[model samples]
Target: MLLDFGCGPGRVAGHAGRALGMRIIGVDASPDMLALAREEGTPGAEYHLVADGRVGGLADACADAAMCNHVLASLPDERTVLEVFTEIHRLLRPGAPFALLTTDPACAGIEYASLRVGEPGVSYGPGEAMPVRLRRTDGTWQSVRNHAWPVETFPPLLEGVGFTDVAQHHPTPDEAVGVADPEHVRSRDWSAERLRPPLVVTTAVKR
Candidate 1:
């Protein structure tokens, strides 16, 4: 079985299920996202709420693999990452794969990297929330807050949680990939910088 851990809205889970034809399960912390998953997910997909970033609810060695995409960067705390790793290790059989895709803020644009955390807001999950002022080239400001992690620390943390054989995929500089349509091109143009290199993809074995 494949556990799509931190599957938001089940979009990727559905696609991955179709592509791999594997028994799939999904987990998420957001009720709204999970509700959408229930409404739109593939017929056989199973889903459950993570509640507190703990996965004790799942049976041991119940999954063959776990995939966490685009959700690591938003986890509420560092311990939550550890918890997820522990949970994944527990849920998967020996030598099962745990894959993750996460944002590396160090690859952020100069403007984005320069922004300061303005008196960070309430703590959530594994970390605190901080307001960021996006510095626009036109001298205008845009405000948003995102969960941040220091890129240099992830490997050790993953290792600490009983993951081994960890491998990271780094961004390739300007690799040409086809855009199927105009909308796709537009979306790429808008998000490319933020989505490019420094977005780390990692895979580890539960050993």
Candidate 2:
């Protein structure tokens, strides 16, 4: 089983459950999001509401592996980020892998397929408001503010919460071989993506 931390609307969590063929426990702080996830109904998946950064009904060290996708961007500061990690750590079994996916602050201003992060040549301080523009399906775009977390900020936090072997992977366009969707990869020019990845996945293990 896997725990999807800070799962919002269950888009990624649902897809992950189907692709990985594993039972996913999707938890979020928003009741509305959990309601939507339950309505969507992913096979072998469940949704729960997390309150005060705690997974209320879950026992300690119950989850096998856990992932947090695009969640740190919403947290305001390092203290809040650490609290979330600490709560997650309490639920993960020893040696369970924890994967955290976040938008790379370094890739700010680069226009990716689905979104464009921050402004060009604009430097955002830690936890400051980093503007992001996401492209809609209708070829329109919507703007939102996401908190900026430096790529280097995650390692010490993970290590502090009993996670070890921390590593960050910046996957480029050149590494897209055997991707599930080749057509999407060819939909746009990936040369810029090859130059710099707009996202980062940090992995660690509970110790």
lDDT of 2 by residue, 1-207 (tens): 889999888878888888788888999999999988888788888888888888888899988999999998898898889988998899899989999989888888887778888999998777999999988878899999899998899999889989999999998876776654788777778776778888899999999
TM-scores of the candidates in the order shown: 0.73, 0.95
Error of 1 at 54 (Å): 2.5
Q: What would the per-residue lDDT of candidate 1 be over residues 1-207, giving only the tens digit for each residue?
A: 899988889988887788787878899888899899988848798888886666546788999988988676566677777888877788889899988876555543323332433333332333445444655656577877767665555678878878899888764324424412344334333343444454567889988
Residue 47 alpha-carbon offset, candidate 1, angstroms: 0.5
By lDDT, the best candidate is 2
Candidate 1 residues lying further than 4 Å off, grouped into runs, are: 110-143, 172-196
Badly placed stretches (over 4 Å) of model 2 are none
Score candidate 1 by lDDT: 0.70
- Clash pairs, model 1 backbone: 76-125, 76-126, 76-127, 77-126, 77-127
